[model samples]
Target: MNRLALLLAGSAVLAVATITPASASTASAGEVDTVTSCGNSGLQSGLSTRLCAEVTGTTVEFYGTVGLAGPPSPGGPGPAPKELITTLSTEVVGSGAAPTQQIAHVLFTSANLQVRGSAATVPCGSTVRATFGVASFPWAPRPVAHEVVITC
Candidate 1:
């Protein structure tokens, strides 16, 4: 009887091990995952920014510029002049499944910028990356603020 019990236990253990995938057992409940994307102006004529993030465990605090476009014609087909501005700021926070896309809009003097992207669900820490450039509107033509990337 003892020998039979030992054989059955060993076979059951082996069967369970074979049925499980390696990733499941290797990843602990405390482990975290991340998602990322790049900011770009696919929808040109104005500013388009991509907000990307890497969500760690749970509860993440992240900050980033949604979108930026540039050098608008002094007077041409573009955003209304009154919308042009020297600076812009935006914010967002929430939780859900993983890899949910988020969208935001930024208005500048000569152009309108749209930000579209995703963020990680909460309980997980979030890391953000952003890019900014000189306003597309005409000004003193200060140094062209090429692509600026900041990590938050």
Candidate 2:
């Protein structure tokens, strides 16, 4: 009975460790890291335009805020905020490191809010703090977003 109990306990521990998600993993020496730099920068609004090429590290997170520009509510109409449909596309650039990209559809209706975004692209031997995507709503009238390239 003692032998059987110990065997079951060990099996359960192994299963639990293997099932844990990467995001849930504990931060350790070899686990989490970050790098920041100046990502793509420009003004975007009206019609449809996109900003790209920005890079940042996976471990690094960027944050920023965005506010409505131009004019205020004509008559303080409904209390509900306006909604803007925006798309975020991210991908790694160049060789030396693994390639990774992700896209997300975001809806912005808040007049002001902080954004957080991250990307990763770190070469084996390089030293520089750069920007990943800025943590600002890309749909804002005037948004200055940065990008992230994550590496360990």
Candidate 3:
């Protein structure tokens, strides 16, 4: 894995683990900020897509899932992919998300599509608005993008 991916992956473990209820202390560094969106019409192909992001401290950890809407079971076999996409691309972009305002693209080959990455540091209480984009897939007219807004 590249350095950036490795760093973000490692940070995910800590960010997800350190989440705690907001405390009264002003020295807050790990208060949790989270958001999830799923089962919406914005998706295609009868797809059940879920986007979640947990921001703890100055780190942002995100994960997403894509599968048929009514799978027999969680992560169960969904309809066969109508087309073979060797690589699927995804990213998280938002205001105050990056210093350069550039999005980070992460590649995936698995259907799980669950990914996590850290973004640029911003002060607490700064409105963090992000759009999680999943590359177009089989039977989908275009890529799917889900917007999430939360405070960190």
Candidate 4:
């Protein structure tokens, strides 16, 4: 009787352990990252924003903000506050296939914004790549853009 009771208890514990639920996981709608560079002659500054992600479907969406900081003029004062230069939002589609690279749309939110050239795109994976030079400033060292690259 004692042996049978012990066996039943062990079996019950095993059953409970096996039937335990798994923890949940979270997924992002997309991912975004930024890169920035300082300006020359205190005229303009350089900034670059890059976003990449993969989705099952042909379309992907991106949203984020880009900012710039400038040092005070020579013999002036400390660095100035960071300024919000742009709020970016766009939908990109693949050229074709499981992995494709496409240049997403770009928008300038700041009234004083000045861009150099144009944005470029590169593929990183089945659903990921990078976009460069989305926006540029007149006083900045060079042109800049908020590039969005997507895969999968």
Residues 1-152, model 4: lDDT tens digits: 99999999999999987787543233345744343322222222343333333232333333232333433357866344333343233323364534223333444433233322223343444222323233243332222233333433
Best by lDDT: 3
Instruction: Write down the TM-score of every candidate.
Output: 0.26, 0.35, 0.42, 0.29
For residue 49, give model 3's deviation from the true position in Å: 0.8
Measured on C-alpha atoms, candidate 3 has an lDDT of 0.46
Ranked by lDDT from best down, the candidates are 3, 2, 1, 4
lDDT of 1 by residue, 1-152 (tens): 99999999999999999999999868887655653333343322244433333344432323333233556567676655433232212223232333333333345443333332333233223332233222444432121111212222
Give candidate 1 regions above 4 Å deviation.
Answer: 1-21, 35-47, 59-134, 139-152
TM-score of structure candidate 3: 0.42
- Poorest lDDT segment (10 consecutive residues) of candidate 2: 126-135
Per-residue lDDT of 107 in model 1: 51
> Please, what are the lDDT tens digits per residue for candidate 2 over residues 1-152?
99999999999999998899867765575643433344444434422222433333333333433344344557875334434433333323444443233333344453554444464434544332322222234444443444433434
* Superposition error at 114 for model 1 (Å): 15
Winning model by TM-score: 3
- Which scores higher on lDDT, 1 or 2? 2
Tens-digit lDDT string for candidate 3 (31-86): 56544443233454445555555555555544555554553566766445433222
Off by over 4 Å in 4: 1-44, 54-59, 64-79, 87-152
Over 4 Å off, model 2: 1-43, 46-58, 62-65, 71-75, 78-80, 96-101, 118-121, 124-152
